[model samples]
Target: MQIKADSVEEYLAKVPEERKGAFARLRKTIIENLPSGFKECINYGMVGYVIPKSIYPDGYHCDPSLPLPFMSIANQKNFLALYHSGIYADEKLLKWFQQEYPKHVKTKLDMGKSCIRFKNVKNIPYELIAALCQKMSPEDFIAIYETNLQKK
Candidate 1:
């Protein structure tokens, strides 16, 4: 489930062996499509891709010491989870993901405003996931996050 690890490598090591393959594949996709300025680290006990303070200075709005998060992927107890904060904050992006997920993922998607839970990890729609990863830049994500903060 929510295993604690200080680094991405440790987090991967802690994941159950059976799920490692799926995690590895997903991790590869995340790396392959992740935006240039986003750095990968372990956050919230999961793999998090973030825009570090070096680029965004202000860091994460929730915690200034941490980087601004773009996305995260985790191996849960009974399922895997992928979170897209950018998509959740934008209606059009969220709609696109909602529309495409069903077409790509053969299994029923268990999704929320920001989180996509995959109980059947092996068949995740990686192509869609990669596209989602590539949809925005760190700067764009920062702009959106700041805009949303203004609304609240």
Candidate 2:
């Protein structure tokens, strides 16, 4: 499932042909809808959206050498995955997404603390994903991340 590619374009090229279109569309949706200030790259082996070192020079607390990751999309073993840090950190945003998902897709939401799993590419609900991408700005995410770090 882990397509060991060095770049986003390379990663996409290695995805199974049956899934190439859906994954590409999902990636496009995130790139187009994400607020300004988030930069795209390959992070943790997935296509990542991050607050770059130029923006947050402190970098990720866990690894100061790396950018602060905001989101990522991966083609996993059984499904496509969207990893959004905002929904994991903010209760209100999580609740809103939980409430809205049923309205967008009939199937029950398959989610983890930060990962939303899409088992069916045909029902990826691109609009809902678009709205989710726009829900947090880099500043907003940085504030929340700092607050959580302080709590620990």
Candidate 3:
């Protein structure tokens, strides 16, 4: 399901035409609501918002050459997927999202930790996703990341 694309536009072009709009909407929502200091780029073969090396010199622990990831979206084989560290790293945020999902989303919440899957356009929880995107600024994310590393 991973297609290597040089840019976000290139990645979007590779998506199935029927799913393009949903992915685009998802991407737009992330970018629009993304907190300051996170930059959008192609990471892990998907559209990603990350902390640039200029800000986080250590880079991603998994791949230091790449920037630290915060959020990302991609069109998968059967469903569009969203990955969010803000939701994954924070139990409170995850719980709040779970509690609010039924209030805002009519579709079943098919997710694993931070990965939220959407099979239909109407089922995409834009508000919930945006709220997560806005919950943490780059500074907040860095602080959490550093704290986690210390505990390890």
Best by lDDT: 2
Superposing every Cα of model 1 onto the true structure, what RMSD results? 0.9
lDDT of 2: 0.95
- Deviation in angstroms for 39 in model 2? 0.9
* lDDT of all predictions: 0.89, 0.95, 0.86
User: Candidate 1: global Cα-lDDT?
Assistant: 0.89
Pick by TM-score: 1 or 3, better one = 1
Ranking by lDDT: 2, 1, 3
Say which prediction, candidate 1 or candidate 2, comes out ahead on lDDT: 2
lDDT of 3 by residue, 83-107 (tens): 9887878788889889999988877
**TM values, all candidates:** 0.96, 0.98, 0.95
Residue pairs that clash (backbone atoms under 3 angstroms), model 1: none
Tell me model 3's lDDT, rounded to 2 decimals. Answer: 0.86
lDDT of 1 by residue, 16-127 (tens): 9888999999999989998799999988788999898899999887889998888999988888899989988888899898899888977877988899988887778999
Instruction: Report the C-alpha lDDT of model 2 over 79-151, residue by residue, as the tens digit.
Output: 9999999999999999999999999999999999999999999889999999999899999999999999999
Sort by TM-score, top down from the best: 2, 1, 3
Task: Please report the candidate that would top TM-score against the real structure.
Answer: 2
